[model samples]
Target: MANDPSVAHDPPPYGAEVFAFSHPAQTERLDSLGDLCDPATTADLARWDLPAGARCLEIGAGTGSLALWLADRCPDGEVTATDTDLRFLSRLRHPALRVLRHDVRTQGFPPGSFDLIVARSVLCHVPARTELPARMVSWLRPGGRLYIEDPSFFPAASSPDPVVRRLGDAVTTTLAASLGSDVAAWARSFPAPLGGLGLAELGMRVHCPTLTATNAAGRAWALSVADLLPAMTRAGALSEAGGTRALAHISRPGFVDIAHAMIAMWGVRPLTRHTEPRYAG
Candidate 1:
C-alpha cells in the first residue's frame, strides 16, 4: 500500500471520457485477453469452482466494465461494485448490479456478507495492506472466495538508463515517493498471506513482466501517463526530477517494451473454518 507520506494522489484521473483499448497485430503471447485487467481476471475465474449463481463484490470497480462482465457471467447472481468515485456510477446499468462509494481504507463491510470478493490493482494504493486478507475472510461466508492482484516493484540494482534508475530508486527507498502511484511489492506477499489466513484450496499465477505494450494504443496510454509526470510531481506523488526522468527514459526509441509485472492470488474459505489467531497462544 502507499507507504509514502509525501506523495499526494487524487484518484487516477478518471473523467467522463469513455476509454478505448488497443490490441497487438500478431499473437505471440501465451494468454492474450488484451487490454484492461479484466481479461486476466476472467480467465482466472474459469478455474474456480464458482457455479452459475454466485454473488460477487468488486472493489476498485473502475468504469464499471469489470462489474458488468461479472454480472453477465453470474447472470443468476448479484454483483456489487464499489469505488470511491460517484462519477463512475453513471456508467452502470444491470439488473443484478449495485454501486456504492465504499472506501476500504476508511471503513469496511461486516463479516460473511459476500460470496466472492475481488480487488484488482488496488491493494498497493491503500494506506496500508495489513488487514486485507482477514478482511477478505470477514466479508466471505464459508466456502466463499477472494481474489487479489498487485505489483512488487523493487529498486533495480542496474538500469542502463539514468532516468529509469531514478524512478526505480524513488520507488524502492522512499515511502513518500510512491504516494499515489501503485505499490509494486505489496501483492507479492500473497502466497505467504494465504497460509496465514488459513484459507484452503489456495493457488496463484504470475503473469509477464514485459507486456507487448507495443500496440499503438498501449503506447499512447504510456505516453499519456508520461505526459502527466509534471502534474504528478507537483501533487507530491512523485519527485519532479524523478518522474520526469522516468518518462524521458521510457520515451526513448524501442523503450515501449518497458512493462510492469502482474501477479494474481486466490484462496477459498474452509467450509469448516473456525478459530482465527488474534494473537499467539
Candidate 2:
C-alpha cells in the first residue's frame, strides 16, 4: 500500500523565519497575491498543461486557492496542498484535495510521486530557497512538470512614478538586505539550476503589471505595501511621516504603482530516465 506521508511527523508549529508566514496579515496578503497574479498563473498553467488524473503538489499553498483550482482541474487525481501554517488551507474542503501542515524546508514529498509541482511567491523568504528548486523538481515523475513563480521587486522599485517608486524601492532594499535574500539576483539567474539538473524544455516569463487602486490586483498590491509599513519603519526604510504619505498616495484617486515582476519558470523531467526504485515501495 502507498504510505500516507502526512502521518510521518507531527505538523511543526508555525514560527518560521519566512516574513509573510510570520506576518499577522499573511492570509489576506496571500489571498490578495492570488487575485493579483491569477491571470498570469492561469496562463502558466495552460502552458504547462495540467492533465486530468495527474497527481499534483503545491508547496506554500497559501490559502489553497490555486491548489483548489488544481484539484478541480485534476479531479481524477489527487492534489496535496502543503504549508507550515494550515490556518487558511485547512478551510478548503474537497475530495480531491489533501491539506498537509508541512514545511518544505524540513519535510519533503516522496521522490517521483507527483506529476506536477507548483509554488508562487514562496522561495523569497526561505532560508535555503536556492537549494529548494532542485529538490522539488526531483519529486516529479518522469516527464512531470515543475512551475515556480518568484518576484523581482527591482522593476517596481525603479518605476517612473516617483511617489510609488520611492516607497517600493526602500522597502524592497531594506527587506532583502535584512533577510539576506537577493530576489533580483535570483530572477536574473533563474532556471539555470534546472537546466544543470538536466531537466528539459525550460521556459520563463516575466510580468510587471501596472497597479492602480481601481483594480483588484492593483488594490491588492497597494495593500501589501501598506501591510509592510511597520517593518519598513523598523528597518529605517521609511520615516513615519513618509510611510503615512506613501500609504495615502496609494489610496488617492488616480494613484498608480508598478508591481514587482513576477517571473514564472518551468521545466519538465526527462522521460527517458527510469523511475528511481527507492521511492517505489
Candidate 3:
C-alpha cells in the first residue's frame, strides 16, 4: 500500500526541504550509515540461510546498499527496495532488484507478498510506529521473517561529556520536533507487540558502537548533525555557534562516547493461517 499514488499528496518528514536526496552530501551520509550498520544487518540475514529464490521487501531502503546485497545474495529471487524518495535508489541497476517510491505509512502490499521484510532506522520516524509492525507482518508469507532496527539515544542523552550530551539532545529534539520521531520510545518498546502478531522465534539484540571523531559512526553522526543543524537552529534547540562548537569538539582526537544503541528485533511468521493484522488509521 505504501506505493499507492493516491497518497502522493502526503508529505514525509524527511522531505526535500528536510533531507533531500539531491543534496551534495546526501550520498556520503547514506554511505556512512550503511558502513556503520550494514555488517550487523547482513550478519543477521546471513544466519537465516534464506533460499536462493527468497522474495525480499526492504522498506526505507535509503541508498539501496542492502537491497543490492540482497539481490546478489539471492540471485534467483526478487528484491523490492522502497523509499519515500527514490533519487539515490533510481541510480542502481540490478536485474533482481526493483526500486520503488513508497511511503510506508500510506502505501502497502497485498498479504503474503514477501519472504523477508526489513527496515532500518525507519519506523522511528513514522507517527504510527506502534502499528506499522503488524502491517508489515501481514505482507510476509508464512514462515517469512521480519527484521526491524532503530536507534535509541538513551546512552547519549545521559552522556557525561557536556558537548556530547548537548549535541545529542539537540539532534534528538530536532528529530522529534521536525519528524515526529519517537526514537527513544520506539527503541524501548520495539519487541513488545511482535509477539501478538502471530510471529515466532522472536529475537532481539542491541548494538552500541563506539564513536570517535574519525570513525564511520562519528562521521555519520556529524553529517546527521550538519543535516539537521538548520532545523535545530531554527527551532531554538541548538544555536549556530553552539552547533559549530559541538562539531569542533566531536572532531577532536580524544572525543569518545557511546553512539545510539542500534536495536534489532526479528521474528518469523508461523506457517499457519492466523487472524489478519489490524492497522491503526
Candidate 4:
C-alpha cells in the first residue's frame, strides 16, 4: 500500500506498481486502513498470544503505523519494518524498530528468526507470489504465526449503483491487466497453499468496510480512483469518456460503495521439526 508520489507517472514494473502512495493521499489512506483493520489486527495478535519480547516482522510496512503499534505492544521486542520504497517509513524511529529497504520478491529474511510476521496488501503485486508463504514460514520460529491481509476487489466494485459498478469493474480490470498479475487471486485460492506448506491452525477472516462519500475510507477510495484515472485513460484500458463518467459518479453526493475486500490468513508453523541423525548412525 506504500506508493511514491514521484513515481506515479512512470509505468510501474510489470507486477510491482502501487496505486496509493502520494503525500496527502498516502497519509489519508494509511489512516483509513488503520481504522479499518485495527480491530482485526488487535484480535489476531491476541489470539496468537503475542508474548513480550516477541520478534516481529512487518512486510510492506507502508507508513509504519502498524509496526509502531507492534513496537508499543511488544516493548521489549524488536520489529523489522520493510518496504521497497523506504521514504514513507523513514520518519518512524524507535528503539525497538528497525526499518529496512527490502524487496519481498527476492530477499529472504533470516530463517526461523521471528515469532510473528505480518503483511498487508503486499502479495497482490508480487510476481513470485505463490512461493511467498513458504518463504515467510521459513522465517518464523517453530510455533510462530504468519498473518497476511490481501485485497479482493470484486466485492467492492460490484456496487448496486449501475454506473459506479460498471466503471469500478472497468477500472480494476484495466489496472490488473496492466499490472500483469491478478491482484485478487488470493481471495479464492490461498487456503490450499497454506495447507500445502503444512502450516497448522489455519484460519481466515474477511473484512469488507462499508463506504460512503462522507466517510474516510470512501473518500480515500474516490481520491485514489481519481488520481489513477489519468493513467488508466492513457493506458487505454479506460476510455477518457468513461473515466470522466466514473469520476463524476465517484464524486457525486450520497455515493456509496464497499471498500475492497481484505482477507486475513493466519497459520502457525509446527513446533516439532524432523531432522536427520547427527552422526548418520
Candidate 5:
C-alpha cells in the first residue's frame, strides 16, 4: 500500500541536501540527540505494557538507538527501523531488528501491521505532518499504542538570554523559510487531533531539560546550529557576527538555558469498534 504511485510526493524538510546523512558530523549529532532524548523516550514507552512478541516500528529511526532498545526490550518480537537515509542505521546489528530505507510521506505500511509505533523528532520535518498520524495509526493493530515526540522551541525562542533567543529565532526562522518546517505550532498543538483519529486513552507530557554547554542537549543544538549557519546567514535570519557571538555564548561554561520542550503525546487504538476516544488535553 505504501508504494502506491497516487501518494503525494511531498519531500521532507530534513532531506539529505539540508541535513545530509553523509555529513561527517551527522553521526556525532545523532548520537548527541540520542543521549539527550532517549532517556525520556524510553521512560515514556515503559509506561505501556509491551509484550515479548510485539511487532514494533520506529519511523525515522535515526542512528537506530531507540530501534535497538525496542529490539532488546522485545527480544522475541520484530522491530522495523526505517529512515529515508540508512547509512547510520546500517551499522546496527540485531537479530530481531530489520532496517529499511523508507519515506513516511510517500510510503506506508498495511493496516494493522504493527503492535507499537513510535516516531521522535521526525514528523515535524514532514510537510504532510497532519496526514501522517492517521497513516501511522492505520499501521497499528487494535489496542496498539502510538507515541510521538516533537520539539517546541517556544521556551528557547523567548529566552531571556539574548544569545539563546537570537539563535533560537534564527534557527526557527531559517528552517521555516527554507524547509517549510512548522518549528513550534505543530508540536505545541499535537494532542488535539488524536482524539478524532479513533484512538482511546490519550495522554500527553512535556520534558523541558536544562541545557549547559557540555551537556548532550547543548551539544546537539550547537551541532544543528552550526550546520544551519550558512543558510541562516544567507537568509538574513542571522548575521555572520551574530552567529559567531551566539556560538561563543553557548559554549561558555556559565551559559545555561532551557532547551526546546519535547512534547510527547500517546494514544491507543480502540480495541472495540464502538469505543469513543476521549481527548486528554
Candidate 6:
C-alpha cells in the first residue's frame, strides 16, 4: 500500500465517513456504507471484468451498500454480504443481494465460491487480518480480484492542535482498551499482509486522498461530533473538550482545512493456494 502511495492514516470510523451524521429532513435516507459504495467508492468494483452473473462477496458489508452497488452494476451478478451486526441489512434495495450475519474473524462461507471479495475500511476493525488474505480470498475462484481499503497516514502525519491530537489518540487507545483489541495496530499495517497469502501479489497500493467538507451538508455532518465527544472524554481518551471546540470551529464560516485521509489497496487471487486450515470464519 505504501508503494502505491494512496494509503494514509486518519480515516473515519466505519460508516461515519459518508454517513458522518444523520439528517432529520431526509427521513428516508440510507446508511453510510451505501454512500461509500457510491460511484466514487465502488469504481474499483466496476473495473472488475467478471461475467455478468459473477459471484461477489463483501465482508463487513455495512448496510449492504457495496454489495447492492455491485449487484446493480452486474444485474446478473449474485452478491452475498456478511456482517455480524445487522444494523443496516435492509439498506440493500437490490434483489440479487443476500445479506447474512457472520463474524469475519470466526465465521465465513465455503472456499472458492466467489469470483471477487472486498473489505474496505474493515481490515482495521478485524484483529487477525492475517487470516483474511487467505480465508477471504480462498473463497474466490482462480483469477479473482480482491480490493482492500485501509487507513493510510504517512510516517509523520497528524494533528497540530494539542486537544485534537490528544482526542484522536484517545479514540484509538480507548477503543483498544475497552474492546481488548488494538485497532491502531491493524490500521498501521496494510498491503504487506497480502504477501502472507502466497498469491501472485499485484502488489498492495492505496490512494491517500483527503476529503474536505466544503458543502453545506458536508459541513453539518463534520460538526456533528458532539455525539462522540462526551463518550470519548468520559472514557479518558480525551483530557479536555478540544474535540468539541474543534468541531465547532471547523463548522464555522471560515473553516476550510479539516480533511480526512483514506487508503485503498487491491490484488488478484490465484488458483490452488495453501489453505491455512483454521476454524470456521
Q: Which candidate number would show the highest TM-score if scored against the true structure?
A: 5
Query: Could you give the candidate ranking by lDDT, starting with the highest?
Result: 5, 3, 2, 4, 1, 6
- Which digits, one per residue and each the tens of the lDDT, describe model 3 over residues 26-81? 99999998999999889888888776599999999999999999999888999999
Q: Which pairs of residues clash in candidate 5, taking residues 3 or more apart in a chain or in different chains? A: 2-108
- C-alpha lDDT (0 to 100) for residue 151 of candidate 3: 89
Q: Any runs in candidate 5 off by more than 4 Å, and if so which?
A: 1-13, 279-281
Q: Please give the lDDT score at residue 250 for candidate 2.
A: 73
Please provide, for model 2 over 10-85, each residue's C-alpha lDDT reduced to its tens digit, 9 standing for 90 to 100: 3223234334566776777777788878788877786556566899999888888899888888889999999877
TM-scores of the models, in the order given: 0.72, 0.85, 0.91, 0.84, 0.93, 0.73
lDDT of 4 by residue, 70-91 (tens): 8888889999999877777898
* TM-score ranking of the models: 5, 3, 2, 4, 6, 1
Candidate number with greatest lDDT: 5
- Flag regions of model 1 displaced more than 4 Å: 1-34, 154-162, 168-182, 209-213, 216-224, 231-253, 256-258, 274-281
User: Which ten residues in a row are the worst by lDDT in model 4?
Assistant: 272-281
| Comparing 2 and 5 on lDDT, the stronger one | 5
* Backbone clash pairs in model 4 (N, Cα, C under 3 Å; residues 3+ apart or in different chains), count: 1
Please provide, for model 6 over 47-115, each residue's C-alpha lDDT reduced to its tens digit, 9 standing for 90 to 100: 558866888888877556677777886678788887765666755567788888777767777877888
Please give the CA lDDT of all the candidate structures.
0.61, 0.74, 0.86, 0.73, 0.87, 0.57
For candidate 2, the 10 contiguous residues with the lowest summed lDDT are 272-281
- The predicted structure with the larger TM-score, 3 or 5, is 5
User: Which residue pairs overlap in candidate 2's backbone?
Assistant: none
Candidate 1: the clashing residue pairs are: 4-175, 4-176, 151-184, 152-184, 152-185, 153-184
Better of 3 and 4 by lDDT: 3
Better of 3 and 5 by lDDT: 5
* Model 6, residue 50: C-alpha shift (Å): 1.1
